[model samples]
Target: MAQVEMNRSVQTRPWFRQITPAQWQALLASSLGWMLDAMDVMLYSMVLVYLMSDLHMDKSMGGFLATLTLLSSALGGLIFGILADKFGRTRSLMISIIVYSVFTALCGFSQTVTQLAILRTFLGLGMGGEWVAGAALITESWPAEHRGKAMGIVQGSWAIGYALAAVVSGLLIPLFGWRGVFFFGIVPALVTFLIRKGTKEPEIWEARKNTRSDTEKEGSVIKIFDRKVVRWTILGSALSICAQFGYWGLFTWIPSYLATSVSQGGAGLSIVKQTGWIVIMQVGAWLGYVAFGLLADKIGRKATFILFFGLAAILVPFYGFTHDATRLLLLGPLVAFFGSGYFSGFGAVLAELFPTSIRATGQGFCYNFGRALAATAPFIVGTLAKSMGLGAAFSITAISFGIAAILVILFLPETKGRELT
Candidate 1:
């Protein structure tokens, strides 16, 4: 009875109290990086239709540009992961911020799809690295027990970043057009500089590197593929691939889908309403992210993944096929919640899968590698949309989520309370 009461009380206690000051600061730093990265990357998605008209491009071409960004990000994350493992996570994080920010601003000046594509590919480099650096930093700082929650909070920032883009686009697009949205991407660079001056490297990482010889500290991409780490890497990559493909396939077109006229296979809503709906749906997403962390910390990682993946599988199709604005408004949040929330678990689960020696490298490869493969999703969805309609195009995401659920159940182990070695 005493133990039961103790467990109940602990459950009732707020999760934030368990985190340390330094951990909190690390969370703040990483969350800001992710949030800003989301703002920069999604800015393009928010304005893609306007861009299509201005650049005289089709959905497939726009999706291809998005694909280029994802593809380049794979290399960027892999490279930066090596650098983070070798040099430091904080430094890599800052440099990534600068790279993405500068190029995102440059995207505002693009005259053609070719120009935008080039600038976006360059921006993808920094954009991918931001997650690698930030996730590594936060994962290394927080305790094992709190890792899931910490990652959830950090991943929750993606919604914040998405919301920031929506808010800024809603306000700015009317005044300065899509170009102004891209110009705002440059603002995060200043944030990177401040975080550079303010934060230090995780001591665990420092100790691990300090004990090793200069030669020993060198990072190798091939090491993640060795016998010991390869299995987990494959599993993690599969999950990441499904999540990325499903997410981008559905969301890259949501704004346009919401705003497009009924004749062209959309809701025919105005830009303001579409932006408002997107923002509102993200509230559900934010709740999902928060809930995943808490529940993963409580129930266990495997169950959490299975639960959300299943929910996403069901909702993605419902969302895609539903046409009534009223019904969509109702289903949208639940769809966003389940579809986006499972992401909170990825960084924490992957961080625990490998030791410090190859942590960054493994994570970079797995997360971005899946992203690289998933790069084709947007293009595939776009091409399909030509004949099947946008709603039908998104049903493919349900299949991706279904695969992720199966992989999680069949192969992935529970890392709920496992300490990071």
Candidate 2:
């Protein structure tokens, strides 16, 4: 009897590890895909100045292109979310990677502003799809006990991608020009092969496929809004939109805000100094992502979001006010810590709120749709800066964070420790 009990315990040991090798492989693959997705998307922002000058496009055109990308991403998420649910996660992820990579490379070849805008729109679709499939796959496969960590790690990939884009743009833009930097974006397409070779369908999704009949499966993706789930969908979408508005509105302009001449109502930091500031701030963002996961797991998701976003609302305005480089350097991390930390909770919360049949669809709709709405951030902030000054323009982002805190408190349900289908 002792031997029998020992054997049972041994048999269960594999299930009890924080993250099994298979789970880690899934996380790595998903994270890499997401990282590349971010790299491809962010490449545009990093090189926007060069593109605008080379192509002779004005700020409105640049803002319009950014808006187009966001709108396309919403459509991509909706389409791919349904595909991920109906097909397999691995397949959807592979397709998304391929689509984005091909289009991103194509952007390097564009001769006109119209061509670049069109290419970016399509690229946005693939970019949007990768996250929905990857997030859903990771969330479903990871055990509930460690789900926060898994999503945290996955969410953290965005910072890595952003950092990579900055490094590549800084190095290659000097050597190969902005077009050459875009050409390099093609390298991420190689990641698709890794997915095809390394990943299998998650056990949960595979089991669902085997157990559920076609007729019994959930109906159209629109059914996500049926009587039982629409409220959560609306709440999740509002929170996500608010977050995106806050992030894109402020961070996208930091370099411009810093580097523009003082006569133009800017801080007048040099290019090298601006890059250093941007990179350093991301370090704080990285910590925020990891810390938010651990804190949410301990104190609950709602409390953690409120803490970070509330602090962000307070810190963002202060970050805008300081002109001293030393003070700016010191405050950058704190602003990022509060401003960027709450993002990790979205994966865990969305996963918990939706069931398997529509999980990806729900996640995609809430996130990508919100992104589409908030895509106006760049344009709005730019217009505001043009008229009211950059400092005042950025202060609006703080209000968005404040709004996110309120939404989470009033509407979002706690999702910690909830098992996924």
Candidate 3:
């Protein structure tokens, strides 16, 4: 009877109490992988203006290249998702890091638009793969109770990477030119070594590997869309599309929106001011990521996402109408808080929902497919900006948040405290 009581007590404890040191280490490694991944991708956005001028490309062509990157990212996500499930999350992550870093540096050597476009496409492929593997790695390693916080920390790495890119651009773009900026991009490949040395396959995945039959061991990508999982696949894809469209559409153009001359309806801030604002805004984004994780953990993923999205829908439009620098300084954080915060939920929620057999594949498909849909954001916003104004172009972004909020409230189920198989 005493032994039975002890067993019951163990089973009744919250999931957070179950985490081990090894799981924490896995989370850190995956977070760093994701952080560096963002650094590589954000570098392109930061230096895109200069790259366009240097390559003699127009806005339309620039938009086209961004679109190409997104499309290729979709392909990469699908391919790597399969590989990650078939191979191992750690191996897939290392390969992706190497691929993106090499091609990102190669971008520095490009003399023509064609060359840059090719490099960006390859970079997108690697970029798409990294998140899928990293998210799966962290999800499978950590306990369900703390998974939201872990994923939040992992997602928060994006802001660090984005902040780093801004700093690098502000420091290097003036001295070494954009080419030098691309040169620095290659440094992220060093992260692969840490991953290769320190990380191991999660025990869950190891057990799954050992238990699998010959057919199951094959781990085909087609399994992700099996009847049981297809609804989740579609839901994740839709949510990702909404989030990415709003983010890339509004934030990608914001620096230009702020720095352009008044004739273009911009604030005409100097590069120094632009960089300062950009970096500062990301600080809010970082906080939002952390906060969203905690909130999702406490309340529920669905509830927290709805709250953030609702706030975003209200705040984003207001962000456009205001012109006071001091007001913007105060409001920028809030904008980032709502615009970027909910992303943290994806890693935790998606990881919990999918089975280990197709976890990475599901993550990649949902995320990269959303990116592909979002690839149109720049183009759509650019066309709107050309006709109406930057302020009005941003209004469209608010609609995306509304859509996401509704979908989360209506469609996505709460995943907090759920065990990942």
User: Each candidate's TM vs. the true structure?
Assistant: 0.96, 0.94, 0.94
The collision pairs in model 3 are none
Candidate 1, residues 1-421, lDDT tens digits: the string is 9999987887577767766688788888899999999999999889988999999999899889999999999999999999999999999999999999999999999998888989999999998999999999999998788888888898889998998898899999999999998999999988876687677799889999889876774558888888998999999999999999999898888887887788888888888888888998888988899899999999999999999999999998888888888888889889989999999998899998988988999889999999999999999999999898898899999999999999999999988889888
Q: Give the clashing pairs for model 2.
A: none
lDDT of 2 by residue, 44-97 (tens): 877877887899976567767877888898889888888888898889998998
lDDT of every predicted structure (CA atoms)? 0.90, 0.84, 0.84
**Per-model tally of clashing residue pairs:** 0, 0, 0
Task: For model 1, state the Cα shift of residue 339 in Å.
Answer: 0.5
In model 1, pairs of residues that clash are none
- Cα deviation of 44 in candidate 1 (Å)? 0.7
Leading candidate by lDDT: 1
User: Which ranges in model 3 have alpha carbons more than 4 Å from their true place?
Assistant: 1-18, 217-219
Clashes of 3: 0
TM-score of 2: 0.94
Error of 1 at 77 (Å): 0.7
Q: Write candidate 3's Cα lDDT for 187-221 as tens digits.
A: 98998888888899888888888889886643466
True-structure RMSD, every candidate: 3.0, 2.5, 2.4
Q: Would you list the rank order by lDDT, best first? A: 1, 3, 2
